[model samples]
Target: MTTTTAFTIAADGSYAARLAGEGDALYAERWTLAGPEAYAVPLPLAQPEEADSEVLPLADGRVLIHRRVAERHAFALLYPTGAETGPSTGELQLGGVEVREGVRVRLLPPCPAGTGAFALAAEDTVTTVWQVTGDPSGPRPVARIPGRCSGGVWLDRAGRLLALDRELEGITKAVAVDLASAGVSPLLQITEDSDDRLLLADPDSGLLLIRSDAPGTARLGWGVLGSSLPVRFPECLARTGEARPFAVQPGQSLMPETCGVALRLPEGDIGLWRPADRQVFRLAAPTGWLGGSGLWSAQGRLHLPYATPEVSCGMVGLDLPVSPPPPVVLESPTPTAPRPVPLQQAPLAGR
Candidate 1:
């Protein structure tokens, strides 16, 4: 039985997969179409802090890892330790800094340029957007959008910002803010009274995906720009009456080329669906206790970390083939022999 824990793919199509034994440390290995081989490289992140680390691939071909440094609730961004031996040590910067006591820092996704921008949900119930420019040592506030912001997405291409504002009356509305003029407008109003839910806006496709509770199950609903009602994707609905969607891939929009739904199942299996064909394929599964999973690179490969059945703990790399071949079998060879030679020779000798 083979088990894979974590996986990442380089630009050149080579893959790095990590596996762990029953012990404390994690084992990382590299592989290619040639063959699978193990490398004596340091694990991406260290021991106890491994559970909280998040890995994101940058536009510059480098990987950004966000690790929690200490119990004081501080995070440090570092490059992978075994990344091609280019840089010995990566620069560490503090994120979600405590501006005031008891203020928790929930770091949002950075922009595409890796400019170190994040959202801060303050203890006073105010949400502000902060930008860190130049060096990692200097971080400054760029702009602040008013109205208790819970979740937001940067519309870089459209030059707009979509944020969710939670009202005091327990109503949430999707607002669109113009970055240039700093004006805010209500785009969609969610009257479901679900403050714990999240709203996502895909800038590329200009679509919104909402997580809300349905009649008998928790489900995800998709909405286009001009549509009054959302078209629900039944596959994303939960089966056990649980309203939690485990793993959800952000809606990716490559103009004129839209891919379908990609999410993880409750059983720890990753699946990708193409809406046009209504097809679904399994990407990976948990061989042990999977810590976390996400897309490793922009090329559409997934990275997952879990306790390996063979080793202590490890990671697995899962890549969906461009076009997987159908199952086939190879025929075996048949033996040939000189049949009646012995019988003919005995008859001649007797004659």
Candidate 2:
């Protein structure tokens, strides 16, 4: 089976980077998705990359790969040297920083601007964010956040603000890190005691998909930035076996409720939902799908990338059926003086 962990697409959905191999022979592969048809351009060096090596695609048609080499994590940009063909050769642009020993580093999600890439290096009590590329100079540390952090989500189109779930003490909360000043501020605090995480955020629409146990159990919910309205935990999102929201439709600035959300279900199926519709339409996943990887166009079409035996690079676009909007309804809260900060909205799948 193909290793799914290293598969990643660019923020703009123009390219993809993945590790394609079995057992111990793993090599980095880049897929160009902006053309009429998808094609893979292999980037294999003299030796194979480690099995656990992580790769991310940049908007400039280069692939950034992170590899662990005895006590240090190295970063580099890979690109094809000649025309795309079998046994293609690639050159590694070595300009990233070599992380210190004993530090665990991982690449964050692609920045919204698609020009820069970032990663978190966590030590004992602090995590540092590094700008690996997109700058004239070499890699440098941008932010030093207190406590261990994970789950990176860019909050602005300029890539100025990043949201990360921090774990200090025993609780976890999502906080926004301002890249300019390295300032940290609370972004989500549903309750005094809750593990809240920001799963995904759309810079265009200010729509945030969050996962938190503020409602007793961990459930997926949605909230808007700079909005006083409480977060809504619609029942349609409470599904079994890890329903992760991966892609959010762009260009829905004033209609966050109408934005298309593509979810990866437990059984590797795709779940399409919109806050206004309040229902999840299930769709079958393409074979050899890089799970939890896809992109949504403003036109309501979801493009999923996949690789199969006969076809090396392929992508499929899915269009959801249209339905009229339902009446605005709210779920009744239990009889209490103060309702939950995030009102539990009524079940939305079937109403």
Candidate 3:
């Protein structure tokens, strides 16, 4: 039985994933708004004998399909007319991106709160970031940064700032890239002995999720950027498994939480972290499904994709209550540790 992993859930609550069944097929599943189940249907795509491809979902429900063709990457925008059926390939448009043959070119997630534009990260010697607005046929390269871009996550809600973990100067550090000014700055300086990766950050609240290995064990920590104090996971919450930052839910205050996770199980150990309480909530794996794809929804409802023992994959919905950070500091603070200094606000679109 082939296993499937949850990739990314779109801004419009649509779930896009790849099912590695007999062949690699992308599944387009419809997630009900704050409901308890998902209606998933496989997207029919022509499989090349032995090639690589990706599915990028647009905010308007159209998906851009990128596949390597004739030593070059080919792209087409797929607009599915229904959730259960696959889109017709009648209007498939080839890409206009001219790149060296066999060079790795990948698609980044779409900005849920931004102007609905997504990014294309190409890695040669250095990483080149390209922005694709409404045109998949004409994706223009935007910023170029030194070191290899591992991947980037939005630092703010507007997608103005992106934090990318790159191997620069022999150390992995989180570098912040401002989309407006094309400005790149070092946000987190990971040490030689300890490694850190930026998961997600909320500039408006200065709340950030960074995977840190300083404690001799890989753990998830929530930190307020620029604050003199340290980002701490409650001592009560033992870090056995692993967790990464998912998406930031929309909200004005903390209680529910602005951010979430897609899937956080490393060894069947599932853990949840709350910024308001600064504690990690541990949950046991559910029967029939060992793990979930990832998590997100505007309403604190978690849309999770899971694989059964039958080698089949499906989506499940969970209504989770939000947790607030602890009212009083329980864990010791790291006042002298290097803290994240906030970046300048990026200008709004058309400003």
Q: Using TM-score as the measure, which candidate wins?
A: 2
TM-score of each predicted structure versus truth: 0.56, 0.88, 0.73
Please give, for residues 1-351, the per-residue lDDT of candidate 2 as tens digits: 666654688888899889887677788889999999999987888798888788899999988898777776778888877555655566655565565677788999888788688989987689999998867676789999999898998887778889998998989988889898999988888776778889998776667899987777889998876555667787789863479999999877756777788899988899998877757889889997875689898898999988788887889999965657763533322222211133223233432
Q: Tens digits of per-residue lDDT for model 1 on 136-162? A: 654445445555666655444322343
Per-model root-mean-square deviation over C-alphas: 20.2, 5.9, 7.8
Better of 1 and 3 by lDDT: 3
What is the C-alpha lDDT profile of model 3 across 45-113, one tens digit per residue? Answer: 464312246655555555556666665655566554543463443235645466666456776765756
Clashes of each: 19, 0, 12
C-alpha positional error of residue 194 in candidate 1 after TM-score superposition, expressed in Å? 5.9
Query: Candidate 2 or 3, higher lDDT?
Result: 2
lDDT of model 2 at position 221: 90
